[model samples]
Target: MRCDRIEDLLPAYADSALDPRERAEVEVHLASCPACTSLLACLRAADEALAVFPEVDPGTELRGRLVSIAAPRQKFSLFTLLRKPSLQPVLTAASVLGVVASLYLLNPGRRDFEKNVVRTFHRGVGRVEKLYAQAGGITGSIGSFAENLYASLRSSNPLERDKD
Candidate 1:
């Protein structure tokens, strides 16, 4: 294989993920190319250095801390509506709906009441207008009668009375 192709496969070869044929090709290139051989050696040395580190262990204090964090959640009952993160939004929405429903129920007739008050006011105005017109007619008739009576008392000429 070409030096470039072998270099591309070098990482996979180091990880042992290459097929037998690909491994053979990389080996052939490594033997022919001194530069690639030295690069492979460096990569292996780096891998070994990385692998030399020991695995991390959680101490008793760390384990106790983790257990304390997890203990409160371990007894979660499936039917417990209060413990779920997903239920908070639903609970909040339900509370809002309940408040709105209660307000609506408490004043169910408020709109009808306002409409009734407005209608009654309009009806009262109409009746008052009718009474005012009737009063004006009555006043005009009384004034006409008084003027006629005074005219008759002041001038009793037959021709004038007939003319009036």
Candidate 2:
């Protein structure tokens, strides 16, 4: 890891909350990195110093306060659906709209895509036909040239044919 990034993670590393792999990585980095080691040492000393704040004893009033604060919070359940009675209609409407929207959005390729594919297919076929015609023309010319060479060789007077 880069020295700057390792230096940034030094505080978290000193806290020992980092995973084993992360701790090893930091350890490897700290071995070669003096700046990060110094930062880690400082964070460690600060944490050790903060440990002096002794835990406060909770009084009877504190217990009452905690219960009062927590008493109104109801446990969650699937039946919470029926309590908000007005939300049900809106949620139902939204769900229907979501279904319609999903069906439209998730539909197969549009007409434009199909049209483009067909057009590309026709263009590719046209190119292939043109290539085939050009090849045929070249091969036909070669065949004619071969025939003329054969006829010329079949003649008894190969040199006299030039005088004609």
Candidate 3:
């Protein structure tokens, strides 16, 4: 193996993680290349130093906080869905649909029902449009009023009046 390839495998060789064939190749390269040998020595020294460092236990409060952070979170499930009050509207809609399906299966008057639903949806959209228009008109009037007030103030200022 080349010096570069042996250098790349030095850390794994130090950790005893390399395969026997690769380790032998790296050993041969390291013996022939002083640079690769030094690099391997550095990696081994780092590993040994790390191994000798004493493990420190965290404080009780920090341990508690870490345990809380690392604890398995509550996963979303059907029971979680049932627990959420915000899902009441969804549940109600689902139940209503179930009832409608049963009724349609029995009576088969879904065309009229679909038409009514579409009409109601269109009415809601129209109301939303009217609200947006009203909001736009109000904003336009407020903006115009602010502009007029600013112009009048500018005109009434003694400095501005002198300039004019």
TM-scores for all candidates: the values are: 0.34, 0.30, 0.36
The digit string of per-residue lDDT tens for model 1 on 136-157 reads 9999999999999988775877
Tell me the tens digit of each residue's lDDT in model 2 across 8-69: 77777877778899889999998998888888888888889888868888999999999999
lDDT per residue as tens, model 3, 1-164: 77777777888888799999998888788778888887877888888998899998788999899999999998889998787999899999999999987888777677887899999999999999999999999999999999999999999899999998
> Global lDDT of each model?
0.88, 0.86, 0.88
Screening candidate 2 with a backbone cut-off below 3 angstroms (N, C-alpha, C), the clashing residue pairs are none
Ranking by TM-score: 3, 1, 2
Q: List the residue pairs that clash in candidate 1.
A: none
Q: What is the lDDT of residue 21 in candidate 1?
A: 89
Give the 10-residue window scoring lowest on summed lDDT in candidate 2.
155-164
Candidate 3: how large is its RMSD? 27.0
Q: Please give the TM-score that candidate 1 achieves against the real structure.
A: 0.34
